[model samples]
Every structure is written in C-alpha cells, then in structure tokens.
Target chain A: MKPIQVALIGLGTVGCGVYQTLHIHKQRLEIQLGAPVELTTVVIENPDKHMKIAEKTTISTDISDILYNPEIDVVFEAINGKEPAFTYLKQCIQAGKHVVTANKEMFAAHGRELKELAQKNEVQIGYDATTAGGIPIIQTISQLFRANQIQQVQAILNGTSNYILTQMRDHQLPFSTALKQAQKWGYAEADPTNDIEGYDAFYKLMILSDLIFDRQPDQKNIRHSGITGITDEAIEKAQQDGKRIKHIASIKYDETGNLTAEIEPIAVPKEHPLYAVEGVDNAIHLKADIVGDITLTGPGAGAFPTASAMVEDLCLILSKQSAPIPVS
Target chain B: MKPIQVALIGLGTVGCGVYQTLHIHKQRLEIQLGAPVELTTVVIENPDKHMKIAEKTTISTDISDILYNPEIDVVFEAINGKEPAFTYLKQCIQAGKHVVTANKEMFAAHGRELKELAQKNEVQIGYDATTAGGIPIIQTISQLFRANQIQQVQAILNGTSNYILTQMRDHQLPFSTALKQAQKWGYAEADPTNDIEGYDAFYKLMILSDLIFDRQPDQKNIRHSGITGITDEAIEKAQQDGKRIKHIASIKYDETGNLTAEIEPIAVPKEHPLYAVEGVDNAIHLKADIVGDITLTGPGAGAFPTASAMVEDLCLILSKQSAPIPVS
Candidate 1:
C-alpha cells in the first residue's frame, strides 16, 4: 500500500521531533503498520531554520504550500495558543484533512468548535498530547470511559510547574530559585506565564473536558488557580504534614448543572498517586461513575513526548475510526 | 444518529457492570456523546440468569443473537479463562463485528492472529480491559508513544496478588490469610493459577509487546515465576529495610530482540513508584525514548473498571483513529 502523506504546521520543538521520530523509526513503523506512513511536508516559520532531518522529508514555510496541495491527507498542528492555531486548524478540517495536535491552548479554548467542525467535515481531531504529552490520557478517558459517566478529572498537567515544585520540595529552595532551576533545565519558558500562572494546566483541563465530557467550562466559569502561590516554606510544611505539594487541575460535576473546577497547588499525601509522580511528569486521574478512578502518568512535555502524542493521533487518523456513539 | 448497538458475550461481573453502567449513565453518556450507545443484545449461558436489566436486553443463549446479526457493530467479551470465550471472539471478528475483550488468556495465546484477522476483516479488535482492567496500559503505550521507541514496559499487572502482598505489608498478616481475604473480596480466582502462577501478568506483557513493539514472545522463551515463592520472612525483611514485596512483569527489547522479559515477585524500595502502589490496584510503568517514564495506576478488577476499559475500546473503535505512523 502507498504511504499516507502528512503535512505538518510549525516546525518548532515538537514539529522537529515529529520529523526526526518519523525519520529515525521509518523502517520499523513501516514494518509494523504494513506500509510507510510518510511525512511529505513540514510547514515551518522558516524553511532554513535549524532542524535535524534527512533529505527525504520535503519542507515548506507556508500552510498554502501544503494545504492547497491535494496530496496531504493529514496535517499535524504543533503551533499553540490562540488565533491562527484555531483558524488554521479549522481550515484543515474544512479542507477534509484529519488533524492531530499537541496544542493545549488552542484545544482548551476552541475544542468544542473544533470537534463540531471535524464532525461536520467527517474528519477526526486529536488532542492526546494537549494534557499529558504522549501519556494517552485523552484517549484513555475518551475511549475507556465511553460507556460510563465521567464524574471528575484531576491531573498534574504542567511539567514546568511540577519540575519547579519538585526542586523546592527536594532542595528546600525558594520558589524563585526553583523556577530558575526549572528554566536552567529547559523545563520552563523564559516568560513562563502560561505555565506558572496555571493557564497551561487549565488549558489542558479544558481540552480534557471537551474530549471526555463532550462539554467544556464556560469561558469564565472555570475556577482556576496557579502554582505561583507555592513557596518553599509551603513545601516544607506539606512535608512536615506528611504531604507533597502538587499542582493539580481538576473538574467535577454533579447530577445538576453545577460544575466545580480549578487548577492549584494541593497538598497531597506521599502515598497519593500524584505525590509519587515527581519531576517534570504529568498525570491524569479520572473518577467515573462506572469505570471507577483511573490515573495515567508520564512526561507532560518536551519535543519527543509532545511530538510522539501527535504521532499517536496520526495513527488514529490513519485508522479513520469514527467518534464515540452518543449514549442516548 | 442512532446509538451504536452493543452485544455482551459474558454476563459475569463486568457484564453486570456494563449493564448498570449503561443504564445509570444513560443521561450523561447521551449528553456527552450526542447520541446513545445502547446494550441491545446480550449473549449468555442462560437467559434466565440473574443479571441487571436481564429482562430489558435481548438476552440470548447463542452467539447468533448478536454475532451473526448485521446491526451489532461491537461485541464486548467479558469472559475469563479460555475455551468458549476465544471461540466466541473469533466468530465475532470473522463476522465483521468490532471486538473488545477482557480475556487475557485468550489474548496472550491469540492476539497476533487476532490483529491480522481484524485487519483482514476491515474492523477493530481491542483488548484494553484484557490486561489491567481499567488502567488503560495498552492504549497508553500504543497511542501515546506513537512517535517514540518503547524502550521497556514494567507493570504490577495483577491486582489480586498486589492486594494480598499489600495486606501482608500493612497488617503483617500471613500470605495465606491475605490470600483468603482477597478471595473473599473476589479479587482472586478460585483456582488462582493464572495470577499466583504469573500467567496473567505474562499474558498482559504479551499484549503490551504487541502494542509497543509488535513482537510476540515464544511461550517457552518467556520467564515466568509467581508470587507464591515470596515468603512472609522475605516480606518482613523487606519492610525492615524500608522495602516492599511486589510482583512485576517486564519486557525490554534491543537490537538483537528482547533484551530481557520476565514476570516474578520482587523486593522494591519505598521510593520506587511501584512500592507506594497498594491494595486491589494495578500499575504499569512505561519507559520510552520520547515520553520518559510514566506510571499509571487504577483498580485492576471490578465490574466497573473493566467495563470502563471496554468502553474505552468502544470509544477508540468509534473514533476509528490509528497511529500516525504505526509503531505496533
């Protein structure tokens, strides 16, 4: 069989990994999948940007360069946050190209519309990497709980915040020092607003809500808080109290329409799943009415983890599986 | 759109939960999925058996009641052990019905042929519940690491054995007493050959091998040991050393092939991710080239968790998503 040609938007960290991953494991992936699933084009900010790649994967700088061409059946959007990510994604769906993204920001804000658009266009949109970067939290919740009532979802969704908190807990360093350490280790951003302010986790939670609950928080209703309030003293206090400070994002709903959701640093016992989860790791805990509680932990970010998530989505796109059957 | 029609092959614990789950979450599932996924056909040993909603569904004694019918798009097989369960699943796949099963024994023995058969039939065959009930380990590794190499898979896959060990650790009780208690709680089986003998965990490892590496082990090549060899003195010694006794299943591959693969009881330090996991819980720790180390935990068995896993497979089947470039 012929390979399924793919077009990627934005050759950033994750985009670069996608290219490298496909290139490195091309033969193995082909052997298992029964044929080659190729990356035909990579749409990046600049075609001459520093990237590790072989000569085979053709690169492009414009979305039109790939989108207008009829050869690309799927497009992976790694560009994140607001605007064009949403607009470009919609264009992909409208063009009947299956999409898989590691962009939590775009999905958290615009997932509902994207889902509707994909369904309308009979294409699939995947956000598995949006939360737990290659941990399959989205797939687990969406697939595993399809027959059950999802009551709650709680997660350690931000790797940068977790890395900082882990440093504070281990070294008894102040938040600023820990944050600096995280930056030094490349876990945090230079600006770090989205990650440190809990917006990153909130965005992850929002996308999870859309996928698992098929409903999302109202623009203003999500009760979000961040890890900025965490201090070295707090981490020490938590340890003294036999707990660990974990940045958790959670959403809960009852029989009524009342929804309570938040992303904040919570004091968890050492034995709690999230407490055992350390470093730049991510985890999702699902409390379903029927499925019970399920937790998934893994690398919440990085080039390989996030790009790997998109690749997983690519597999799903290849399968051409339909959406969940509505329980009516 | 009408709900996807479901047929249950076994009316045991999970079957009852699947029924109750579908019934209890009717409204929520409908709201989220935008359509109803219904349990229209149920295949069982006897229609007269006491089951939740036994009277409501089209409960029948033969597979023809669901498998031969064109309307039944999905078949959830919840039976354990071998024999009829394997044959029934084969019939379902051959008849072009998408299959979701929790029968680890059947899967361990037949997954390769089953995957090939499903593809030939142009359908899906998923066993998310087969290994860890609700932990979603298979899907976690299969879809999440779609872009990375699965360096290794380590799991405490059997909840029954874990519960027994945990009781011994916490209460300093004899293994026999803990085993009795676990049996009373229905965590372990009457024979206990599969779990105590490490067969269950071994089979689960096989499934993971299929998902992450697409490689199946020759039965003779798999090293299998059981929890039976773990003594009370060993447990006490480990606890004195701030360690714990845990059953582990592991598979690692290198350039030559499987570097190491085995299932056995082991001593784990208090700080290891597997150490803190206790009770009727299952945890799978994954080490991938991309995502790093991610550990997932949840109830290993129960009516709801397994059904939740099957439901997850249903969601995957519905979504019809495959890996971008298939790793397994």
Candidate 2:
C-alpha cells in the first residue's frame, strides 16, 4: 500500500521526463496504481549540471548507494548504455527488486536471460519503452497476441530516420536538411548516427525478437542496411512511381519455423499499413494467424513517451502482473 | 494446475471460429500460456442442425446447462441478440464466472452493470473482440493510455463499411455493387443494415466509451451518419481535392471535459494516416499528449480476427495480469 520506493539509473532526457511526469501527475499516479511511485534516488555523472532541475530527487554518484537500500521496491534503468545497466538490472533481479527500463540496447542483448532471472526472482522486467515509446505494443503482444501464432513482425521502428525520409518525400527537402530540422525540433540527437544507420531500429528489433521469438536474434544472421545513402532523388523517384520509401525492419518466421530479419529501405505501396506512417513516428505491422494482422504506431522515442512506458511498467509491477510466458 | 474450464455460449460464425482456433492452436496456446487451455463445453441452440466441427467439446441446447455447471471457470459469450447472450452473460457473472465475450451489442447496451459486477466479483470481463477484432485497440486504451488522457479517437472500426466505401471509391462502382462485393468477400453480413446504417460502429463506440471514459456513451448524443450517403460523385470530388472519403467514427473529450462523438465520412488528406488504409482494412488513430499521436491498423472484423481477440483475453485471464485501468 505504501509508495514504490524507486531509484533512477540516469539523469538524462528520459530520466528528466520520468521525474517531471511523475511529479506533474503525482496525484493521478497514486489514484491509478493505488500507490505513489516515488523516485527516491537518481544516479548521475554530473550532479552539478542537472541539480537545478532535479533538486528534489536525491542525486547520487554511486550505484551502491541506492542498490543497497532495502526500501527501493523498483529501479528504472533510464541510462542509455550496456555494461552498467545490464549489471545493475542483474543485481536488482538478484535482490528481488522489480525493474522497469527504457534501455533497448541492454534488453536487446540480454532480455531472455533477464526475463528468466526475473522469473527466478519472482519479479518483473518490463521494457515497453524499448519498442514503441508509450504505444503499449509490448503489452498488446503479450496480452492480445497471446493466443495467436505471431508469424511476422514488420515495423518502421526508428523515428529519426523516418523524419528524414518523410521530409524528403513530402516537403521535397534533402536528407541532411531534414536531419538538421529534426535535431532542431528536438526529435533527433546531436549525433544522429545510430538512427540514420539503422542501429536504433536494430536494437528495437532485437528487443522484440526476445519478447516474441524467446531467444536473442543471431546478430550475424540479420541482414542490415541504413538510410544514410537514401538521397532526395531516390525519394522523388519513388514518389513519382507512387511509392513511399520507408525504413522497414521485419522479422519473419518461415514455414519451417526459422526466423529471419531484415532492416533496410524499401518502397512500400500506397495502401500498405506502413505507407501512411510518416514523419518522426514509429509503426509496427504484425501478421498473426488468429487476428489476421494488427499494426501499432506511435512515437518510438521521446522524453515523456519513453518515461510513460517506464511508469506503466511500475504500475504493472505493483499489480503483480507479468506477460503470459512466451511460447516459442 | 488444472486447465481453465470454458463454456462457449454461441456457435455461430465467431463461435465456430473460436472453437476451431482453440483446437488448431492448442499447442501454440499451451506453449504461449505455459500450459494448456481446454474447451470443456460449448453451448449450441440445436446440436442436430448446427454442424459438429469441434468433436471434443460438449454441445448444449439450453442456457441453464452452462449456468448451472459451476465447474466452468469462464464463459465465452459469442451469441448476439438481446435475449440469450445478454441474459446468459448476466447470469454467468452473477454466478461468479469470468467472461470473455465477442458480443458488442450487449456491452454497448448493458456493460456498465456487467463491468461493475465483474469488479465486484474480483474477476475479469474482457471483450477485446468487440471493438477492433484482432487489432488490439481496446487493450491499448485500457492498458496503454491509462496514464494519459486521450484528446480524440478516430478510427475506421467497421470493415464492412470500409470495404464498401473502398470499393466504391477505388473501382468507381455503384453503392449496390460495392455492397454486393462486400458481401461476396465475407466482410458484410447477409443483412448489411448493421454495417451500412452505422449501428455496428455505434455499438463499438459505446464499448470504447466505457473502456476509455468509464461510462456508457449516449448514442442519442452522438451524431450518426453512415457510408450509405457517400456517393460516387462525392468520392470523385474528394479525389480531385487530393483527398479520399473515409468513414471515421470519432469521440473527442473537449477542453471543458465534455465527451462528444460522431460517425460520418471525412475527406482525409493523402498525407493522413487513415488515407492509405483501404479495402477491408481498419485503423484507429489516437491523439494524446505523451505519445503525440499513435495509430493501429488491421482487420476490424472477421471470424479469425475477432476469434484472435478472444484468445488474447483468454491469455490475460489465464496469466492473471491487468493494468492501466483507465478513465484517468
């Protein structure tokens, strides 16, 4: 009945959003979850720079400061890195603490092990923010697609690349200009290589693969390409041919039950579900046996949207709910 | 751990599909659910006249047969109409059995009492099939959008109407021909009044209203106009204006917090998410604060699609998980 004594692993954009949204919607959170989700501690490298905004939240330069605290019911891994997020999450699971994370990279590499560990500890590790930020696609897959054979998952899962390509096609702008515009609009990072080169989508694909396929996707087997070389001329030509150029990341299970994936630029017909999906938005279109096909689209990355997913996970943990264990 | 006992209340198109889908995907269901989900009894109006497809499931002629059997853990209410399906579900809930129904009409009319009754019994009553079939839009609202207030929900929720409108617009066919084509494609019922008149969508709106708004939306207050009035000339004019006619059902919560709903044709721009959504395809676009705006697309209605939603509910029940109890 008490508030979830929580620790945040970073003080970055999403961490700031998590802190801000939780503060802004404090009363609503208490009513919705039947408990207050308090961010008791935040681990940051530069406490001096972020202290003005995160004054109320207890800032720490040490991980052990929060990890050793018995009052922390959950830890949110908001930091965008691999080694420490993975290590901290493992420790949390071992300590029987529930975890809610926005770290797609960490989940992409080690989700199956993390899921198993969470089960062993009888806790939950929810990564809704990892796929489509705040879209609830994770819960949709776990809850709604539970009874169907999820044959294929295809998505435009990266927002930055999408913004570039959509602007090129719709506004007749070049990719570089679009990228700069996205950065100006706060949709792209200062160094947008991960998004432009399809690495962000690759990370998302790995996370979904873990949730759906129940195994880490073999990195060597996945066919990968980026939108770096996709030019304005190509976009114009595709548009002239009545086609839309989209960065599509798709994983398909063959009749033999073998999973194969591709992340590349493709010409989608005008009527495809992913065709209408434009701008800095993410869309996932799935083909399941029972449901025929369902597509979910939303902001794949943002401060509040990403934070919203983590907060949703905190609610799930308090509800003591876990996704239906994946079949295969 | 015994299997959850089930009593299917109807064996019509969706009922038959549910039974068949359960049997066909029994292994997948077991693997996904970490156990098997058995269909113990099926309620049929007439075993002699109705085909015997599900050989293992027991067929019943009377409603009391299932209602009296306390061993049934859940009741699948697939039968429509006000008399049997509605009455039977009320009795089942009164008897403390969990329910997963595909009957949208019952939910639209009498769901307020039923939802409260289920909560009183500390059980779940899921009707994911009632809204978007396999598209998983219902769960998205109840779970994903719980923390955020939705500004508007605009959707192509009815596949029959969408198919008719799409054929009329794309092929330049007359209304009668397009209607015939929809029937031929199994998108429309023999009596297409429910779809063409927009009553089916109206009922779905009521269900969504309850799930999102936590109150039964008054159909009297809603502005209703179906695809029947969308003429070929209108479609031509829309195309000339670089737009397409789409039957959009929308409910908007205003700045003052008043809820208003409408079902009518909209001339959606080509750049819009709903523009490329064609044929029997259906899409729901949600405008919200946190996630900016998100859209989900798929078959809004089908034996398989609706059956898949039922299966998803079964997983939710079997797995013991719930969250984002919306109306926030």
In terms of docking quality, model 2 is medium
Worst lDDT run of 10 residues, candidate 2 chain A, spans A319-328
lDDT of prediction 2: 0.81
lDDT of each: 0.78, 0.81
Interface RMSD, in order shown: 6.9, 7.4
The candidate that wins on TM-score is: 2
lDDT of 1 at A100: 86
Name the lDDT of candidate 1.
0.78
Clashing pairs in 2: none
Compared with the true structure, model 1 gives a TM-score of 0.86
Candidate 1, residues B164-224, lDDT tens digits: the string is 8988878888878888888888888888878888888888888888777777766666778
